[model samples]
Target: MLHLMIAIPAFARMYNVSCKMCHVAFPKLNGFGQAFADNGYVFAGKQGEIYRNLGDDRARTFKELPLAVRFTHYVAASYDGGKAMTDFQSPWSVKFLLGGAPNERINFYAYVIFEKGLPPFFEDAWIDLHGFFGLPFSLTLGQFQISDLMFMRETRLTRSDFYIYKVGPYKITYHRGALLGTPIGDFGVVNGNGLSALNGKYYDDNPSKWFFGHLPLPADFGLFGLWGEDYDTLGNYVRLYRLGLDWRGVFESFYPFFQILVGFDNDTSNLFYGGFFGVDYAPGGDGVVSLLFNYVDAPANSPYRNERLATLALRYSHYVLTNLKVFAEGEGWLFKRSLALTLGVDFAF
Candidate 1:
C-alpha cells in the first residue's frame, strides 16, 4: 500500500527535492508516484501535526497555518444503457479536502464526501474574503468547486464525457451562496451568486469568471452563469450560461487539449452544449498517453429531454517504481444516450 515502487525516489532522495517537486509523473510507467499520504503528508512530515492542529494561537498574527489536506479516491466499473438498462457495477468516490489561510484576509475551504450511493455532501464549503483593493479580490462563502473552463481539462480519475450532465457537463450541483475570485496573476475572476438559491435553479451567473494563460497551456477561460428554477415544472428558466476555452501546447511531443460548453435554460426554451478534445503523449516524462473526444447537445423544447452525447477516452500513466503509480481509464459512448466507464490507481505517500 505504500510501495510507490521504491518509495518514490526513496522519498525524493530523502528530501532534497525535485521529483517534479511533488510529481506530476512521467516515464516511470505502470506505477506512478507521489500521493504523499494522499496529500496531507503536509510537505511529508505532516509539519508538526499540521501546526499543532490547525494553528491560530491567538494574538492573531502572521501567516503560517494555511492548513491543507486532500484525499481523493475513485474506484470504478461501469456499463449502463439509455433509460437505465444494461448493467455492471463497482463504484466508489471518496473525497475529503480541507484548506487554510487563517488571516491576511481569511480563507478556508471544504469538500467532504464519502459516497457509495449518496448521502454525504459538502462538495466544497467556502470562506474567502481577501481584503479587496481592486484586482486582488475574493468573497467566496460556502459550497464550492464549479469553476468550469473544462474544469482542469481531464485526467482526474475519469471524466466520463461529463456524465450526461451530472459529473460535469453543466455542473451547477454545488449550491449555497457567495462567489467572487480575482487573483489575476495566473489568471482570475470567479463571480457572484445567490438571490435566494439561484432564484431559478442556477446559471444566471451574477458573476462567474475564470481565466488562465499559463501553466501547461497557452489558453484557458470559463464562465458559468445562471437563470434558475425549472427542475421540473413551470417556465422562464430562460437563463443559464457557460463558456469555456482551453488550448494546450507542446506540439513537438504532442499534448493537445480543447474544450467548449454552452448552456441555456429558458424554462422550456432549453439549449445546452458540451465539448472535449484531448491528447497527451509523453516520451521522456515517463508515461502518459491519452485521447479523448466528447460532445453534448440535446435540448430543444423540453419536458426535460435532451440527447446527443458522444465520448471516447483512453488513458495510461506509468511509473513502475518510485512513489508508484499505475493508471488506466477507458470510456466509450456514441450517437445519443448513456454509457460510461472508469478505472483508477493513485498512491503518493
Candidate 2:
C-alpha cells in the first residue's frame, strides 16, 4: 500500500496545543486553523499571544521563535499497463519550518527543504501583513508558491502525477532547418557528412545555434529579460512575470476559495492564464471532503495549448496517542485518469 504523511508538529509545539485543534488530519487545516493563518498565526484571545511586552511604550521581545523539523518517508509503486516500477524511499525528504508573530500586525513564515539530488533552498519565505490601512486586505511578499492561495497543495495527501504548481504553459520552438525541406523550398541537403548550411550559416543537427542570448534587464527597470538563451543546453523559454490573486472565505458551513493568475513568457511575449475554484465541506470531526476545478490556457504557440485538471479528495484522521495520528486519504485526478490512495501515520511530540 502507498503511504503519505502531511504532519506539521512544529506548530503544535509553538501554540502548546493539541494538533487536532487546527487540523482534521495532519496538514489539512480546520476552520479554526484557517483563521489562525489569516490572523497572522495568532489566536483571537489572550491565550494566543506570543510577544513578551504588551504596551506601546515598551520594546517588545518575542517570547519564543519556534522552530520545528519534520521528516517524511514513503514507498510507492505505479503501473502504466507496460512495466511496473516499485521503489522504497525512506527518509525521502526533510523540512525546517519557522513561523511566528514578530509583532501585532505582521507575521512571518519560512521553510527550507532538504531533498535528495537537489541543493537545499528556501522553498517558501513570505511575510503576511494582517491589515493594510485598517482594511480587511493583506499583502504577502517574497518567494512563495502562488498555487497555495487557492488549492492548498500541502493539505493534499496524495502524490500528484502532474505538478499543479506549474500552472504556466511552456513555449514551443522548432528548428528553422526542419522547415526548409519539402514543399517549403530546400535551402540545403543532408550531406554524407551529416551537416548542412543555410543562408551562409553551417547547420548541423548537433552543433548549430538556434537562438541567441539576450542581456538581462536590471530589476529596478521593472523588466527582467532572460539571463541566457541556449536552447540546446538550457531551456528554450523563461518565465518573465507573474501576477496573481487568491481569496478564501467561509459561508455557512462551506469553505470556498477562488484564485487566478496571469503569467508572461519571456521568449514569445505570450500570455498564460490559469485559476482554480474549490470548496471544502467539513461536517464535524475527523473527516473532510473537497472538490476542486483547475484550468490553464496557454498561448496559441505553446506546446501544451491548454491543460486542465480537476480533483476530488477526502481525508480522515484520529489520534491514538497524545500527539500521534493515524490518517488516510484518497484522491483522484480526473484528467490524468489516475487515482492515488495513501495510508500514513503522523507522530508529533
Candidate 3:
C-alpha cells in the first residue's frame, strides 16, 4: 500500500516539472513520500501555476470578495515497542483553510484544524501587507506561528520537532503580533513582537545597513535574539526572551547544517529555561540525499523553560521522482516509542 501510494505521486511530480503545481492539504506538513515525488520534490509555494491564478489577471477580473479554500487529512499509525498494526489508527488530524490575494498588494491565508478527539479550533490566521511604505518591507499581524529562528516543519532538523508527542509540552503555539522585515544590504532583519505596543522600533520607517541571511544557510555567521511580552487589557502580562546563533559553512557539504537556540520565560513569580539543537544537510534545493536530526532540552524553571519536555527525531526525504519529490519518511519518540510511524504520499497538481 505504501509503495503504491508513493509510486503514483512520484511519476506525477516528475511529469509536471513543477513542485507547487499540486496544492497540498497542509502547506506545513507537505504530504506523503510519494505525493512529494509527484510534485517535483518541492514544498508548496505561491510561485507555481496551481496558484498562478492568484496574480493580477484574476485579482483585476474580480472586484468583489474573493476567496480560496484548502483542505487536509492524515491517518498514520506506527509500531515501536509494540507489534505492528494493520490499519491506520493512532494519530489523525483534519484541517480547513482559506486564502488568496484580494488586491494588488495584499495577500493572506488562514487555517483551522480539528484533531481526531479534541475541540475544533482555529490553528492560524495571519495577513501580509506587501509594498507598504513604498519600500521592500511589510508588516504581518495576527495569531500565527512565530517566524523566529525555525522553519515550522516536521523534518526534524528544522527547529527541533520539540512537541511531536501528543502529551509533550514542547509543541509551540503561534503568538499574536506584528513583524517588520527589511532588506539591509544583501541581508534582511525581521523584528517581531507578541503584543501590539512593543512593535515600535527605530527602523520602522527607515532602512538600515543590517543584512538578513538565507535560511538553512545564513549568509553571515552571527547571533540573533528575541524578547516578547503579552498583556491583557488590564496590564497583567507574560514575558519571554530567546537567543539564537546563526552559523554559516560550519561543516562538510555532506552535513553542512547547524543552529542553536536558548529561551527564557517569565510570568511574575517564576522563570524557565530551555534550549534546542539542530543539524542537517544543506537546503537540498534540487535534491540531496541527506539526514536531518533534532534534539530539544526543556526544563521547568519557573517561566524560562516552561515546557519541561524532551524530544528527538530523525528524518530523510529524497527527490527520486524528479526535482518535484519522491521517497518516504518515518519518525519515532522516546515517550511512546511503541506505536507511531507516519507513512505519507506527496504530490502537486
Best by TM-score: 2
Model 3, residue 325: displacement in angstroms? 7.1
List the candidates' TM-scores in order.
0.31, 0.57, 0.53
- Candidate 1: which stretches are off by over 4 Å? 1-48, 52-56, 59-144, 147-155, 159-237, 240-264, 271-307, 312-333, 336-349
Q: What order do candidates take by TM-score, descending?
A: 2, 3, 1
lDDT values of the candidates? 0.45, 0.49, 0.40
lDDT of 2 by residue, 57-80 (tens): 457556675676766554555443
Per-residue lDDT of 14 in model 3: 29
The local lDDT score (0 to 100) that residue 97 gets in candidate 2 is: 76
- Model 3, position 179, has a per-residue lDDT of 47
For candidate 2, the 10 contiguous residues with the lowest summed lDDT are 177-186
Give the lDDT ranking, best first.
2, 1, 3
Clashing pairs in 2: none
Q: What does candidate 3's lDDT look like per residue over 1-349, in tens digits?
A: 0000111222233234333333221122233433542232233542232333455665432232223222222345557566776455323444454444444356565656666668766656667665656667655556555423343432232212544221122223344545454453112223222222332554222221112232332474545555544442455554545555545343543434345655544533343334444544434353333333444454444432334444454444444443234333455455445434444333222
Better of 2 and 3 by lDDT: 2
